[model samples]
Target chain A: MTSSVTASLPRPSPFHLLLAFGSGGLLTLMVDFNGLVGLYATPFYSSWVAHGTGIVAALAFLALLRLRPEAGAGGAKPAAPLWAYLGGVSGALTVILTSTAVNSPLALSGTLALGLAGQVVFSLAADRWGLLGMPVRIPLLRDFAALALIAAGSVIIIFGRGA
Target chain B: MIEAILIATLAGVLVSLSRQINGRLAVSTTPLVASFWNHVVGFAVLTAIGLVIGALWPAGAFSAPWYAYLGGTIGVIFVASGSWLIARIGAINTAMLVIGGQMVFGVALDLVRGAEGHVLASALGVALIIAGAALTQRRR
Candidate 1:
């Protein structure tokens, strides 16, 4: 079941593109706010606070969603395994590791560059192997082109800020 | 230097790892449900670490402006969006597009705040990223 080859889905619609981009923008804002919190409090505290607040926000949104049932909500999904819920552990560890790297000789720029590389490598592998229960996708040529351009652009932005 | 580099790279890997895990949960449940668990569980773990290390209540922990505390609110939406996108677009597309957006938006944010930097390099970087995004939109 895990090794099944699923055909590539239709290309992402423009709406998905927009949402993905907007999500990244949300990330910028999140880092900005959390970074501020970190300055006054500990990094752990900042993350903890974000997670705590996230719980409230999620609960509120979940409640609101309950009021209005979604259209085509679809049939019941298979239950997620216990380990599927451990994503937070990976996230918490990221904070600890990243903070340690930021203070090292790598500084912010080095860390950013290397982190970008790491993400690219892992994401490619994730898709190739369908790791972690996601679907498998045979990356097309355009995918590599996209990755190169974005990675190049991100690196420039990272180093250019120092200029 | 080596250890730090490895750690930084590992951190990035974990970013994808976290997203992948949460994405799985989102598949079984809704994205928002997965995000909720991600945050609450993270909160629990961090709280334990903070207590163990005696860093739970730092100096002036509550002194931040009210708006500064809103990251998690945005985060709920952000994580949910990633979970939703990854399944549809696959991990690489999701990661690339989002990274592009973050870089482009970061420069825009800096500019908005009147931050200092070489505008030329930023422009070049933004152009490259935009071109890259266009490639994804192109249907063969």
Candidate 2:
């Protein structure tokens, strides 16, 4: 059992950074596409596209995880209390459900800001608890700050379109 | 144009932060979970803001479509999977593949819709995005 657990954990690979950047780029595209669709169509259509894509992607992730248990286990376990999960789920539901009720641009902006805040909080908690996995490493403070700037930039871009 | 830029910038930051956080958390947690968590948090924060803004400046806030909200769930999953892929591939390689895929997909979508903007402009934007990704990627 112990061996299996260890085997299921992720192993350090040289390709990690590449994977991060590639995935990040793809994610950015997905968000942008969804926002554009939302502007042109009903907010409902945007949700459909985003959710539809997510389902497909999630399935793929599951398949990969099943195929390579070791890779899945590479990171530290979440140190967040159960409430964190609840908070996250509730927050997600609120944003999604309210999208149609709110202005598209403002809604998008709010979502981005909220999402960043959530991640930051979670990261801090994880770091404090030392719950992150073995193979993963949090960015330095400077890197984290840079990331925040990038996120801010994306929000500005979205709003700038006059959508 | 501004919306796209904002979304791009925010997405970039979120992606970077998520990766960093994921690295610290166990690898088993998966990008899906991380993305999910971020979305959850994001949703909560945005909702609060929306409520506040609605109260203060009603004109700025408008009704959203139900479908758009559903997109958040989908986004969460994509982010998670994409992040995991990042760990498997190097940032540059992954960025290349994703950007290429996004371009193909985005162009198809735009063509179907008869969207504005010249092909050249779109291409240029894609190139810039790729370059930005390359800049942010970690060196071995």
Candidate 3:
């Protein structure tokens, strides 16, 4: 679980950075829509519906990518280990756990903030050790500095919500 | 309180773990393919649970505004992009940048919806977030 952090730092390309950031925007939208579903039904029902739709959407996207201008989903690739295919189980479990926590005294704001902390901590270790087959990256002083600023801003936004 | 905190935190952990695992699959297959598997597998599991619990058709779920159902479509792209980004940028950068984006965009969404909040705090928070993102984009 613990591996020595890498020594050197490599900058992310501009394109990759944009994609990552843009995807975050997509997340906000996803959460908003999914939460609406939850409000109408149970969170479990909400998640189940989303996943059901997601499967159909994924198929559409895969077809588009395969047919279009420059997408490359072709070429035979190695068969994924069984464990690699279990990401959805992790995702499904998240919905249940989060639903329960949100119903608790922690509420949405607290749950969001704590979830942020968990994500940050886990990713730090993930980058440090290259957990789950990612490239190892040792966060440097600059990285910590950036994190501090983002964390502060996030805390303010989260706790400062709704009047 | 403690239980809530732990569960909330664990939920976050699972979010990252799911991405990491999907990313690994993406390494072998394309990110889109990984995302497909993610949705299909997740749908299957949820279906089983829904069957067992018999709560699949809970009241009012169907009447949710049409737009709500679109979240699943958006999620396919979101999960695919996360898988792609994690393998390319490493997890920390991906997480930081994505969270920053979500926060910034969330505030924007709130503003457009005319949601109430402390304006000064919102501005300050946004400023800090942009600055943090700039720091992230700094040349290594």
Single out the weakest 10-residue window by summed lDDT for candidate 2 chain B. Answer: B55-64
Give, for candidate 2 chain A, the lowest lDDT window spanning 10 residues.
Answer: A86-95
Taking all chains together, each candidate's TM-score versus the true structure is 0.94, 0.42, 0.93
Give the per-residue lDDT of model 3 (tens digit) for B23-118: 999888888888888998899988898899897999997988999999999999999999988887778788888888898899999899989888
lDDT of 3 by residue, A1-163 (tens): 1333333456567777688779989999999999999899888999999999998888787787663212433567556678988999999989999999989998888988999899899999998898977778888777888888888898799888833
Candidate 1: pairs in clash:
none
lDDT of each residue in B57-99, candidate 1, tens digit only: 8997999889999999999999999999998898988988999
What are the runs in model 1 whose C-alpha is more than 4 Å off? A1-9, A67-74, B138-140
- Pick the winner on TM-score between candidates 2 and 3: 3
> Model 1 has how many clashing residue pairs?
0
Best by lDDT: 1
DockQ of each: 0.74, 0.14, 0.71
Displacement of residue B74 (Cα, Å) in model 3 is 0.2
Q: By DockQ, highest first, what's the ranking? A: 1, 3, 2
CA displacement after TM-score superposition, residue A53 of candidate 3 (Å) = 0.6
Q: What C-alpha lDDT do the candidate models reach, one value each?
A: 0.88, 0.44, 0.86
